[model samples]
Target: MFHKVVVTLLVVSAAVIYADVYEPVYKPEPLPYYFNYNVYDDYKGANYGQQEKSDGKAVYGSYTVDLPDGRKQRVDYTADHYKGYVAKVSYYGKAQHPKYYGPAVTFFNQYGNGYH
Candidate 1:
């Protein structure tokens, strides 16, 4: 009877230890669950700035600002293996459309050509 009790106790303790060490697998839900989300903030009376997602390879981000004169200003930036780092600021709802400054200028301001 004592041997039977010891065997049963050991079995129960092993099961408890195994259960404590187990981890459940994680699975993400599908995209359709977010169909009612706020996708963009570009409309009138809406907030302008938002931070977007980034892939594993690149550090990517974007933001928008509503100008006082009814135009919208947007800035998109990224840093990765290909570009190192780049930023672009632009305007909308106006006649002026500026060009993209090259990455050299951006690098100069950030690190001063590696000397700073």
Candidate 2:
């Protein structure tokens, strides 16, 4: 009987120690950061800008780009663990396409020396 009691006590102590080792602990802390950038190149016709910030729990940002049809496209967004991601899109200018003209030159022969 004494031996059985000692074995049972040892088993209970080992089980408790094992449970403590595997238990998880969590601590929450606020994280904050911000960043922004802009790019404009007249020769390449590239224009864009972006800005973003976060406070661990929530993030907010906006970005703008020059569209090919002579319009600016912008998007504002926010994200968090609860709300996921949401965005609002808007345009700044009207879109326009350049006038199309006739082909620059007449068609020419496609085959060279009629070689097969």
Candidate 3:
């Protein structure tokens, strides 16, 4: 039994290593694919490509912005992260935009400095 356990661990470790689990692989299919009610997070983005209501305060956006090629980005400043379509992704260093300026769903994990 002890030997079996060690062998299992080795196999699992090898599988995990071969799978490359420690990288931020960004897949474009989710951004480029069309959105519909049924497809859901079946793609990417926190929500199922649908904007959601947060309690009674924040309004969020569906997927982070997927800017079309050759367009100016307009990133909205969240708690500490900037989000929006690639076209609307604001890349201003140290620049921040109020969450209220954007839809509420984008606040899925909006928090920083002192708040959750």
Candidate 4:
């Protein structure tokens, strides 16, 4: 029983050592690419655009969109293994909203009640 235990321990140690020394035969290289798109729909009141590029190590991009409040939102961003991700946001044009008033009373009784 002692001999069997010793043999099993030796086999396990050998496997651990071999695993530590093992290395992949092939390493895939990063691919670089770039893309951009824009959209403008006057009927739906939609306007936006985005562009991005990467050279394996780092990525850079920017996007812009029209806000419902009549303002344009813009964002510029960058990312990499070292810096991770960073973004700078800005707005263009003033925001405008229509004045709000209480619901209209189409019909009312003389007593100021909604029903007669």
**Can you give the lDDT of residue 79 in candidate 3?**
26
Q: Each candidate's root-mean-square deviation in Å?
A: 14.9, 10.5, 17.7, 10.0
Best by TM-score: 4
| C-alpha lDDT of candidate 2 relative to the true structure | 0.91
Worst 10 residues of 4 by lDDT: 107-116
Best by lDDT: 4
Which segments of candidate 3 are over 4 A away from where they belong?
21-26, 30-81, 84-116
* lDDT (10s digit) by residue, model 3, range 1-116: 99999999999999999888666577443222222242324255222123333322233333333232323333332221244322224522343444564444422344443322
lDDT of 4 by residue, 1-116 (tens): 99999999999999999999999999887789999999999999999999999998899999999999999999999999998999999999999997995766567778776842
lDDT scores for all predictions? 0.68, 0.91, 0.41, 0.95
Superposition TM-score, candidate 4 onto the true structure? 0.67
Tens-digit lDDT track of model 2 for 3-59: 999999999999999998985677768789999999999999999999999988899
TM-score of 3: 0.23
For model 1, what is the alpha-carbon lDDT of residue 29? 40
The collision pairs in model 2 are none
Clashes of 1: 0
Candidate 4 residue pairs in clash (backbone atoms < 3 Å): none
Indicate the residue-level lDDT of 66 in model 2.
99
Worst 10 residues of 2 by lDDT: 107-116
* Predicted candidate 1 versus true structure: per-residue lDDT over 3-114, tens digit per residue: 9999999999999999999887986542311111234455556655557555556666777876766688888888778879798999889654446645552335554565
